[model samples]
Target: MVENKHVLEISSVTTSDRGVYTCKASNRFGADICQAEMAIIDKPHFIKVVKGTNTVLQCEVAGTGPFEISWYKDKKQIRSSKKYRLTSQKAVISLEVSSFNSADVGEYECVIANEVGKCMCSATYILKDWQTPLIS
Candidate 1:
């Protein structure tokens, strides 16, 4: 008699690992085949932003379909207004702050989720005051 059950496991899957896989079982009497497809959901990743008088933060994410993106400051949800502008283009997500200052210094986070999974990345905003040199 042939065993009628099987299992497949994958760990730390990457984009290259996504593809179709086939399983086949055979016996002297007959044979059977089955196929499955593997899909990957990439976690959110922050892109390096240049710091200046104004502040902008951005992240990139990839996955299958209809993603919900949200931004948070110090664990509280934020929305676009005169003070903040949120935008999404293709896989890139961004937040722009108009006239960033000491008041805006805190932990900023971007959360992305889909039917399959959820992921987030965060960054801290720190303000530094510039000092002028005194010449005698």
Candidate 2:
């Protein structure tokens, strides 16, 4: 029963869970041990924006690849209802608001995960009256 690595799925993993994970595999030839270290992290920072203007929210990370990005509002998944556009390049991920409004005011999230580990980042923006700010 030789294996390369072990897979573990956990929700709400925190810094306290940071430690080493060991996998033991034995075969007729011999036995081997594979160890992996992981550290839990806090959510991403929020970016502020104004109303009636285009906005881009970004999240950056290290030591991860092939991630999955998601947008959220007040902690809920941002639905794909044709109001938001998200794009990723290499390690950079961003959310594009074509037409900004009060509805776009909230927190956005970028979730990254690879075969080795997973991480998440967050961004928050508020939509203010862009025209009104210019008057004052």
RMSD of 1: 6.0
Model 1 over residues 50-124: C-alpha lDDT tens digits? 333357777766675478889998999989999989998988788887766667878888888887778887877
Q: Find the 10 residues in a row with the least total lDDT in model 2.
A: 44-53
Clashing pairs in 1: none
Model 2 TM-score (2 dp):
0.49
After superposition, the stretches of candidate 2 with alpha carbons farther than 4 Å from their true spots are: 1-54, 79-81, 130-136
Estimate every model's Cα lDDT from 0 to 1: 0.75, 0.59
Q: Least lDDT summed over 10 consecutive residues: which range in candidate 1?
A: 127-136
Model 2 over residues 1-136: C-alpha lDDT tens digits? 8856656776788667788988788889999888989865444332322222247666555543445556676777765556777766665566776666666666666666666555666656663465121100
